[model samples]
Target chain A: MSTATATRPATPRAELAAEHGLSPSSARPPLPQYLRQVWARRHFITAFATSRTATLYSGARLGQIWQVLTPLMNAGVYYLIFGILFSSRRNIDNFTAFLVTGVFLFTFTQRSVTSGARAISGNLSLIRALHFPRAALPLAFTIVELQQMLVSLAVLGVIVLLTGEPITWAWLLVVPALILQTIFNTGLSLAIARIGARVPDVSQLLPFLTRTWLYMSGVFFSIPQRVHAGPLQDLMMANPATVYIELVRDALIDRHDAPQHAWILAVSWAVVAFCVGFWYFWGAEEKYGRG
Target chain B: MADIQHTNGQVPTVIVDDLHIVYRVYGATVGKGNAPAAFKRILKRQKSPALREVHAVRGVSFTSHRGESIGLIGRNGSGKSTLLRAIAGLLPPTRGAVFTDGQPTLLGVNAALMSDLTGERNIILGCLAMGLTPAQAKERYDDIVEFSGLGEFIDLPMRTYSSGMQQRLRFAIAAVKSHDVLLIDEALATGDADFRKRSEERIRELRDEAGTVFLVSHSLDVVTKTCTRAIWLDQGSIKMDGDAETVVNAYSSATR
Candidate 1:
């Protein structure tokens, strides 16, 4: 995301005086500088991608098939246990697809945020020694998770087709919805990464966070139907996750309108979550670089 | 004045001023009135000390021009590593400013590194971490591998390498940068005598190309040989700053 700029901060060693736009006291590179860092580290990502696709796929029991089959298996297990045995399928149409969409999106967010949270803390050596932007830490995890989620996306499309959820222009809104979701994840990932790094306890609590998040994020039930009547419904609707899931459901399940103001709400929530998360994360940038 | 103009054109690779680094460790300040963590807390390792802020570095400042090789000399807890970190922009100073001409690469010596990563993979990351692009990283990949001489082991997890082997690889990776400044934190201590000799040669090449280096080492011999100047820090303050031979000799005598 960061392209190299002409006026990059050199190092902590050189004093820039008054003319350099540097306050003379500030040595750290700015935000755009971090993007350049991400660009520079593309080789690490590339090498890792090559190795991962090989090692993970080749050394596995199911090989590349696991990429598609893993999420399907996950959905099937959840569906059998919840949709059939528990009889929760009565609430939503094409319950399999509903569960799959929710599961896939929520899982993507969960993994991206949790793994990105540890991105900097885990690479203890690199962060301290390397003079690049730290934002790349979370982006790396998001990129890797997004790559893995590609298979899940394909499965999602196939599931939608088989379940006969008719594709339409409203379904095209899924692209923007997905973009918003990714943006939300990036912001949350950076924020959580900062929290997890300093506290140490956060690392252990992350799985719990993800699990609690799944239950509350409307993975099991549609928002409006799940919580009916009173302030509870209002409260649930206020949740960005509820909005995100609803937008996805709207696009995939009810795919024909011009996307109502509710998608606007989801998009707005994504922006807010990103801004809040980014600000929170950057606030800790100083702490992350310290010993 | 004139110095500011010329300085901008030929800025010192690194500058540090009135820097203090304090860490607010959530651990007991005094040992009394505390029990071992309970099971749940223990699982989370709730080893909280009566919450005191430990001051790691205090009011330190210096500037080094390109082609200058500087050494950090101090006892443990005297803030050598903290000082290097502050200078490298890895650690922000609590109450001062650090300025630089270009990005610096910090080469930590003798650190317990992951042996599971191959030397080559680590090299790619290490070089990239030093702020080189993919093509740039790839260009140095072979040179760094050859310099470290890990050959077949380049593909193996670093865990299998002995301490000495890991040090050589880390040194090669950190030093592979085309940096205006490079920070070394005793990371070269594990290399063999031959590697050290060759590594010394590379440090000079970097300097000749107008790069600056801030190296921290306990070895007086390394300081005297590798650096032109030295800052002897004590209790996080600069006690002596002069030619390497002068400051190191004075610090050694005072300690003795």
Candidate 2:
């Protein structure tokens, strides 16, 4: 160590630092090492998520009940407009169950992506103060949405039963579908976190983007009847949001049929989104807190 | 540079090599602009008229050895906090680099780690965030709680605590782990005299464990009392670097 430190008068200071076995303070670790670091902080991630979810409505009078009420109200307003006003329930049995399922499922993705935008910017204090993997913040945000999704799931079950939908053995498929949706959301949250940190204006634009996605996902209407056959219908069906919604609708509503290729598309979308999002986010790991 | 050499064959733990950190703040517009103008500017890859560049730490270099506590003394906006942030890996350097043997824990006064959470939770989360396992964090829990002297207030939300209490909790959580390098930015100033003395003793114990501590404080008395060496920075460059007493005296007399 002394030899490397002493015989380098011509060397730049960076090289001298390297000779002393020092790494850049802000350098990103290798991908595998980074993933390991994230895994080790799983306890932190879960604790943070639980705490955030608990405090999300602490200021409101309704408190945690709003967790269930917020989604129920969203479904109510959409039902009044689309179900009663526009008759978006055209040719679909159990339209109440269908619409509720769509709103709840799509909301999981919607909240994940939107909150992902704020994950870094909102938690600048925590990021600057602590030395954990920056990925934990996004992961925690995703889990917060997941906790809410679970609450919404319980409400969805009651709404489905009230709409007279049967609970077949196929209802078990909701587990796999939700699991896949979560993976996809995690990846998307990670990617959006990095983007939102760099371009804060993205947060302003996210609602519009997510709204457009919600419409394209056929959240309120039955795409099979409303959309004409061709590439357009196939494209809509292949949409990850639409795919997850359809899978859940199939499992819950006895009359609703998912596309034969739904499971394949679901798995593919989850894998692709997660891998790309993780890789893209990791690319800028070291640049998170800096201006 | 001071004639006193504290290096007793210990290897250098931190090498801040000619570090330069420039902060670009948006929304400092000189002229009013509408949406279309902003869009056109973005499309053309031209910087926003609101852009303002601040060169905070300009080519500052220093090497810190193990078991040394160095106090960074400077006036407000003189880049003292920015220098510590750069050393903690929270800020990217505009030029040159900061290299460290291990991760540096930065204890800044502004962020209490988690303000909304209870002090008890913040301790656990803060410890876990710094890579301590749940078991290790739990083991350190009582020590941190006692060190903070938060008492029953520990069970209350951190936001309810005064700034001094917040700083105490932050220091206790940070000091629990024996870091390879610890960069504290004005966190100790909020503590009362008793807390300050306790923390100074803790800082000494940390140094005895072969760790390097870089403290940025406006309190010259604290600097002279706690640090073995001191560096006075002015306008982003070291004005004087020497014995803590000598540097503090020079800085005080010169400022006077």
Candidate 3:
């Protein structure tokens, strides 16, 4: 314990002022500086994301096996309902592969958005305790979803091969389609993260929204054959989820042909969502930790 | 009471000017007199919920210079933690301003460390969060471990450690880098006597190196012993600010 009671001799305020500059320090840092800070902590961001991914299924009895099992189980249910019961696979060749791709891709976006909404709100204590780039939380959540998707992708490839689709150079197009889908998912994650921090209850409403989107995205059945040509058809085709899912099905399965502008629409939606979502989230950076 | 200003050659590291922090607490209960009206409002499903505004810190102002250890002594809910958080830039000020010469590091107890991770991993994570590169954090790893005294237990998950051990580790990680401004909130309250002594010594060394420290503690004895100056707060306002011994004495007598 420092029990030094004697006060030190006073010094002139002018001399003190001359030695150091004084300015308000609590204001948000400039945009470039903030970007630089985020860039500098890139390693921490990746590590955090990886660690969360590693522990995500730690509590479950099956652990990481669930990652592969989840999407496969969903595909099984969809096949039983749409392929067997409804006979929706009438016109489509290799209907199993098509349904598997649709379910896997659509679920990737759904999981990313739902988990991303909880990113900031879930880590409020971490946000309050330490100073770092707030964007890292949502980015980490997206990475976790991405890691799970990689597992699902492996299973999807095996399913497509087992269904007797010949290996072709066009199969490599799945890579680009996946990359675009990931960007779109990242953007949606960031947008939902900001809203989740504010409303908190938005998370409860997300599942319904994603379910509606999943059905409209042509995951279980072919939208073009079912819906007639009109503004509604155009709107469905324009949806980025539908565009990306259709692109993947076209690339992996030989019978289906994607629209001429599918690639254009996919890339455009990815870039626009990323830019708009990032800007919206950054605008609320300083307000995230407090009410 | 007369205000005591530091006129020493040391530069002012923190200047908190007329700071006011307001908290908007939602779902406030309606009073007895308005029971029927509240029931009617609830039945109609009002768009805006009931809210009560709490003035946590009201127009408190002070200046702290380099090489000074100031203690903020207050009762529960006197806004001591809120004021420290505002200075650290974690909480935006509702009004007024806080100016500082350098970045302020707030020593938050166990809040930043992941419970499932080993103590060693948390040390690395915490260092990275404080803006240290991976290499720099690695370089300081041994020193931080030694300071924390967690030695062999560092390999175990943090959830296995006692709260006191966790707090010590947190303090060790925050103290690894000599900060220009450090805000401590009840960090010393959990540690044992030996740890407290070493923490006080470290604080003195920081002051000697021209660092500024703000300690918010309920223990007046700790304040008088470790801090050179003290500011006593009551009901979100400063009641006294002077020599640590004088303020502590006054505060103790008034409470008794």
Candidate 4:
């Protein structure tokens, strides 16, 4: 023990350890932990990214075709009941397309957010044994969800084309919108994931919560145009999802100018969600390595 | 993340600096067997603490040079696993520091694997968890498959493997990577007599190569056969750290 205590480390371990008293020890991890994590699973993440994405599409026999088809089918069913049945007293042109895109995107965000709720608890083995960014869990989750998003987008694109919505410059906004949506999803997901690990009840109610949220998201109505008709409508329209869905729809489908408040709402929601989620998740950094 | 390969070729391989570790368990759905069946407890409804705290590892400090094979002998709840976990950096010490030459692998009694995934997929994930690169993992894949002896069943889900089989596969994966320091948490009992002998030979080879190994096991036979040194832990403190047989013999005699 005395012999072990006599020696001191000589090599630079990490910048954080050298410059600051942060990280595990005064020394940096010899091999970058990130490199180790990536090295360990380069093949797996890649294979999973491609294989799961492809297989998840369940494609060849309209197998994964359900990726896109499932949302569209839901949209069509809802459109018949809501647009044609109960709301038949009113009128809105191209209502099915608008509703489907909104419904589809809302579902993507909801699924991405809630699935992250189970991320840490589900991977207890890896977390307890290995040291990597716990962020990796939600990031992988976001990637998988993005795969579903791509399938949904393909479906929505075909519908937009068939509905005679011509391609235009506004389509460029979709890329940024998609990127913002991903960041927003990651933020919200991490936030939910932290609490969900400690509170098992959160996972149980996640499906119900998401279902209830969809109604308030205005996927079945002209939320932007008639957004202030009642307190309920006003409240729904105020939701960040409402702004996101309308912004995407306005740019891609309606080919109209977005409301003045849309960007304000979207950007604030994203920033708050990102900062709040990242810090909240980081605060629980200790739990991840525990069994 | 700390490595201490000596320029003078005499560096210690592992170090613990006043290390402490903590764990908090929450929302455990304890079955209600302890609850009163009738109105006997109605007058005294209990509202106990929700967060159960276990001081698994206390202010522990120790280190080992490159060739040391140290065994930890202790009772079931005697903090042996917790100390191993702290040294492995699996659980960060709450009050101190652990600096090792490199990362270690801690394989406990329960072989932890993603049950839904096949043994082969788990093999890949296991290697990755140990920090092996994809190409390196690929190169080592054949050897790993052969060593586990699970054979064709390697492609089947790990949940299907017997607990013993799972342990063997885990050992195979963790052993593929060389470490400046390696920690085993009572992971013996994976195979029959011959395989244990092979594992002992492998540990000897690793020690001769100047790698440090930390093993925690209740079996005195394992400590006697494999370790150069041993530490006896009880109630989160070291009772002894010295020659393996001498320490185990003392502890065993006292307990008896």
Highest TM-score against the true fold, candidate: 2
User: Per-residue lDDT for A1-291 in model 2, tens only?
Assistant: 112323435335566567768877888888999999999999999988988887898889988999989999999999999999999887888899999999999999999999999999988888888898999999999999999999999999999998887778998999999999999999999999999999999999999999999999999998878899999998998999999999999999998899989999999999999999999999999888874
Deviation of model 2 at A112, angstroms: 0.4
Preferred candidate (DockQ higher): 1 or 4: 1
> How well is each residue in B131-250 modelled by candidate 4, as lDDT tens digits?
566777789999888877778999887778888788788778877777667788767765777667767777787788778898988789999899998988888877887789899999
- Provide chain B's TM-score, model 4: 0.84
The TM-score obtained by model 1 is: 0.81
Candidate 2 clashing pairs?
A: none
RMSD of 2: 3.3
Q: Which candidate is the best by lDDT?
A: 2
Flag regions of model 1 displaced more than 4 Å.
A1-70, A158-174, A250-262, B1-11, B28-50, B110-117, B251-256
Each model's DockQ score:
0.31, 0.56, 0.37, 0.23
Q: Sort by TM-score, best first.
A: 2, 3, 1, 4
- TM-scores, in order shown? 0.81, 0.95, 0.91, 0.79
Ranking the candidates on DockQ from highest down gives 2, 3, 1, 4
Model 2 chain B lowest lDDT segment of ten: B1-10
> Looking at model 4 chain A, which ten-residue stretch has the lowest summed lDDT?
A13-22
